[model samples]
Target: MNAGYVRLSRDDDKRNYTSIENQKLIITQFAAENNLIIDRWYEDDGISGYKFDRPGFHQLMADLDKDIDQVLVKDFSRLGRHNARVLLLLDEFQERGKRLIVIDDHYDSMQTEDDTIGIKTWYNEKYVKDTSQKIKRAIGARQKAGTLMIRPPFGYTRSHKDKSEIEIVPEEANYIKTIYSLYLQGSGYRMIAGYLTGNQIPTPSMARHAQDFAKGVISKHKIAIQWSDSMVRDILGNDFYTGTLRLQKRARSTVHGKDKRVPKSKQYVFENHHPAIVDKASFDLVQELKKKRIKSNYRSSHAQPAQPELSSPFGSCLFCKDCGSRLTPIRRPASGRERKYYICTTYNTKGRLHCSKAHLIEEETLMNDLIAYMKLCRNSLCKDITAYNLECTGDEKKTSVRKQTELQSRIDVLKKQMQILFTQKIRDLANAHGCEKVINESYDAMQKEILTQICESEKQLKTLRNSILTDTDKKERSQSALQITDRIIEMKTLDRRDIEILVKKITVDKDGLPEIELRYGLSHLIPCSPSCHLNRQENEIIYQCMNLILQSDRDYTSARYLSRALTDIHYPKSAKGVLPYIGLMLKAGILSQGSSPQKPYIINKNRFEIKKVMDTFIKNCCLV
Candidate 1:
């Protein structure tokens, strides 16, 4: 059956010109002109054409089960403006043997060429870009005219007669004065925020929400009210209190979407553009004092110095074992000298009652300990390497032989399953139509699914049979790890780069005792056959992921924490990317869980399970 989809959004037009009624009328006319029967008319009112995620769209998608033969729309942009999303929807329709017609764009999915569809889709995307550029140019023109294009600063509000002009808010101005007074009186940003929070004074964000609520710009429910240290710092840094408005403090690129601070040379500073809450002299004085305090804080040592060692090689690798928060670098006055040490960030900010431990470990002490740890790791690897060196140049090739035999065994089982399906098909249709009758649709479908499985198993077996490693390949690959071990054994001191090569992360407890995690290269140590289910990188990631889950003391952990832990050890990884690794582990019975994958994983017999997995690597004499 043919269906029509129509949508209109306020962003398209404030007036009812692009209303739902108008779009439906257009679709109706198009269907009538083409002599097509409209089974249903789906309407999405007040929804953006830029996004496909609408209630009406989802309902129409669900109705595909009713055998929708064709979909008609007023235009391609009405279907959706985003090129990639709209194209994907078109592809889905094509795959299901459904036709799509866009009247205004003169595009028909069944009749139009791929490149023609692509060009029309490109035009739809370009419309959004053109609109964005126009708005940006308008803003630029206003900026050149010294017009205030941003929201009112902390102690000010938009003028009653002129919305672009700033006016002093008497009540908020008093708080602004108090903040400057406190800073001049030697109060830090943290203390200032605390004082305001303790007194029940609304923060800048809360105050802005209050103004927005008064003007009916936003609903009362959205007035999220809170005070924080960063807010106080932002208020203190703003020079708007001195009757000067700053513009272009930060710039965001259209291509790369991250905001970066515009250099001082490029930033525009307009003086005396707003009502004064603080004098220019006071603002300048506060800025100078801030500079001095920052310079003092960054110094190496104070008074009598302890024996200086190399600077902290570990940048953000160390963490507090108890809270899992990073160990922030701090210099504390100790026995008439400044000592550089790391403390748990949570305890440093929230106090001991929250974390119950400072986790204070000096950098020099941690550095020396790390050096010793690397040496110990190198020695252990060297012993393993020596044994592997004595082995007969990979003569038996036990791992590849075992893997090939296992894959062949799986293929045998799949072949048997196929044969059984053949027998079942014969019995199922023995006398359905006639003696020469073909298998029914149900049996045919079953056969297809089984055939796919059998093909995959046979392919895996073929790959295993072809991928054979010789004795020389093993010795050559093992050389790099052996060289690294030998180098670490001869080294007297270690730096940050050296530490990165040896360790992944370092965890320290409340008592300053440390636990180091070595980055053992599993892919190189236990090489996979060319036809293996996983590649070298995937195998390494799987091994590391399993170790992280099993080694943790907690029985369960959120997907978020697992992803973050991996990211902190490696690159900036998100929870979604780690799912495949988790799937692989689950497939091999190396990891187990009782809850949903979205929920926390409950590692069952984690120690025993992980040990069994590691035993496989050891049995293969995996060392490279």
Candidate 2:
């Protein structure tokens, strides 16, 4: 059996010799001429010649297990551009006692003895490397010049008049705008992709080409590709929709020459080259969301402790109106001991209350007030949203005048260009191509330019339509968000899990009133007063103990042991029995697990104070 191989390095070159039909024709002719029966055909279309990893290449290797007689190619270049790969394949053929032939080169593996051919092969290898480098250089130059280089970005098509200008692709451009608008509205990347698929919009890669082949518009059809989250994310992150081009966001190695994407900081960006679908404000909003997503991803990867679920709807709704600190819930013992309440986070890290006043609020009364306020906010938002939507519809008349002026200007330019091209054709005064040729070129340019203008007008119309929908949608969504917040708040009690969905931050005031801030702008004020407060002298003494804990000769295990002991002092009488068990663990060395825990524990002589300060210095940046 004779097998044939083919490859085209410059991608575009494949259009000539590497076509499926051409490969089949060459393989069949070579097989018949050599009287070699073929068993099967292998093909790898659009595969690079520089890489050995290819679909058809694997099939060919697998076929070697069969009783193959020889391998044939139109030329040696079909095998590979790499010299080492060619040499390895040649040695493999020799070991198998199989012959290789390149009909175009008139070379046969069976002959095997030519010093001149060896030099030619070396030269061919150099040629391949040189050609690859030249192509890379050309692409780099185009990128630096701010031209649309390889692929026209999503929502745009390369301009026929000047390949550098990327004209808006109407259908795709509207979809791109929708993606950005939705993203700013808190819809995520995957949601935007789902929306596109749900709307049955043709993905950018598969859209119909506006080119006309009969009039010699490039005779190529675009292949349809499916919508994916990756595609949506790329569009959302791209600055192209904002009329800016960001270049050189990648680098090729100086040694191995493998290209690696350069970091975002290295990218060269120029703004306002084309019309912007997303303004700077919306783009910045999207960026903030992106940052939040990045932070969330990082947190998830580290597996941070799960947030506690809120027990009452109103429980998590309360915050310190003064310092914005969350009021931590403190439950009393089962023995009917008095309930205690306090805040979460250090109120004063530097032994000063100049920045914040620590406030502690009782939990029971806070929830009732929060629930009442939420009901009020919900009704208010509903009323305001309805009023805003009505006002927005009243402004529709303003756009008609602007649209008429734009359309008139575009029509006038198109008519003038058509007349000039026709006049040039009749004059026959050009030095180079005669009037006919000049006229034909000018006519083609005019048609394409006119088409581009029409596409722009259509895009503007779409924008006008979208703008009408936007104000109403914004009001509706805002009302919906407030309603969701109200629902979260209306719950009499909440657990930590419920709180995570609605509450972002909680703060306690000096008066111990907890003011809850909802995720969607619903605010509620409540009375969350603390049961007790240690005097300034007492807190200072505790601070002194903390300093001692840090200066102690004890290790972490021993110090943490002492810290837990001090924290347990606030426990009620019924839970007091558990303290002995803790003490037993300390004595048995189980608390520190046979290691000293003394480093984190502190004891002070003044005010009979005891406290624990863990050694949590994060790389010399000590944080409380």
Candidate 3:
């Protein structure tokens, strides 16, 4: 059987002479003229010749030893541009007793000596390398002139007048503004994404496709209508929304190599190059908030927490004053009741050798203390806004600046060391030290370690730079904190989002007292306050109802069962009367309803709010 192989890459498509159709025509005509019939056809379209692992090529190779007695191509370049691989493939053909034919080069294996095949393969490889370099130079020239062709970002489209420039798409720009607005209003990436998805807003990809469909450029296809946290994060982090053109941030080292991220110092950033969707100040503020959140949530240990979704409001805010480590939440079962508490992470993981005290504080008690502190601050601010100074201290700024300088200097030193090691490795390879394999392996390991350190140091430096707040930023943050404090006081509950906006850290001392640090430099030691006391009669009623539900053996206790149980206990009430208490318990997160509407309720043992309400009632009141 005779096999005809056809291939055409992007470079080949530039000229009609090397098109797939043209190659097929030439091969078919040559076979007909030679009175030979081609039985199998293998074609790889728009694939690089430098890559030998293409599907069409693999199929052709698989049949070489079985059905294929002859392989034909228009030229050797069509088979491959990889010099070594192509030479080895030619040898493979000879060893397998297969006849080879290249019409363009006028080569037939059965009739030719093929002494110049090696040189021809090398020239083919050189052509590809030269073409790659030429294309890169052209792109470089365009980039320097701000005329490089690029796909526009989500909220933009290429200008009709000048394809090199971008203009805002009004509908898409509105979504971009909404994302930034929600982020500044203390919405997390996931929360913002959920909001957009719930609102049925089209994602960037969907919107782009819709435009193309409307223009009749492509047929309509099904696309997912969803938004992801990563999409939200990308939009929020893009300085392009602020009318900046950031380009050349990624490039390939070799023609066939994967693209690598270019360092910030090497990227081209042109400010005010297009219409703005978000202001520079707001963008900077969002970046600062993102950095703070990342720093707070980062844990030294790689292990994930057991219940991340059920994490306390103070998860990121709580810390230990003694060891200066973030506190971790733990749940303990006590007499059939589960209670949540926060302890110093250092003491919990390590022993007394690292930290002397647990600094244990109940979740309920911490919430009460934090609420009281917020109330006190709100009262103080209401009386006189200037009562407490919120200006950042000079010493803190100086220390941060010093640290930034040190990190930058360290990064510079690491880069120099990396260059030196690379030079040393080259010299060793050239000199053929002790064993070639051992020398290469040792240098490769060292190179990997140094590269890892350099990446880590660069990341730390970027985070530090983002964390540094300017004077304008401090003033704005202080005013925003005041507003957030008022809102939290009015709600009388602190959620995770509220904590992220208002508090920087809550440091608990060895005595288990928390010091509240506000975001804009306000710090206070929360004064001890009386525990919340509920009405005795109401507490008794709640206790009786909760006890009945807990004592029930069934997984789900219906409201009717609770009414009957209460009557048997001499506290008679109809199911309708029991509904009120059930509603309150559900609202407090102490009880959860089943998935189906007909199913009853189940106790929520893991909720921290349950412990607060239950313990307070159990201490002050007895069963009714």
Best by lDDT: 3
CA lDDT for candidate 1 = 0.67
Q: lDDT for every model? A: 0.67, 0.55, 0.74
**Model 1's TM-score against the true structure:** 0.42
lDDT of 2 at 301: 11
Candidate order by decreasing lDDT: 3, 1, 2
**lDDT, candidate 3, at 410:** 72
By summed lDDT, the worst window of 10 consecutive residues in model 2 runs over: 298-307
* Superposition error at 550 for model 1 (Å): 78
lDDT of 2 at 102: 74
RMSD of each: 31.2, 16.4, 16.9
Q: By summed lDDT, which 10 consecutive residues of candidate 3 come out lowest? A: 299-308
Task: Report how far residue 65 has shifted in candidate 3, in Å.
Answer: 1.4
TM-score head-to-head 1 vs 2, winner:
2
Name the regions of candidate 2 deviating beyond 4 angstroms. 1-48, 54-57, 102-111, 150-178, 191-228, 250-259, 296-624
- Give me the runs in candidate 3 sitting further than 4 Å from their true place: 13-16, 160-165, 177-188, 219-222, 280-315, 320-504, 510-513, 516-624
lDDT of 2 by residue, 438-550 (tens): 66676676566555555544444454444432464456444544455555676666443345445554555664544445554433322221221122222332333344344
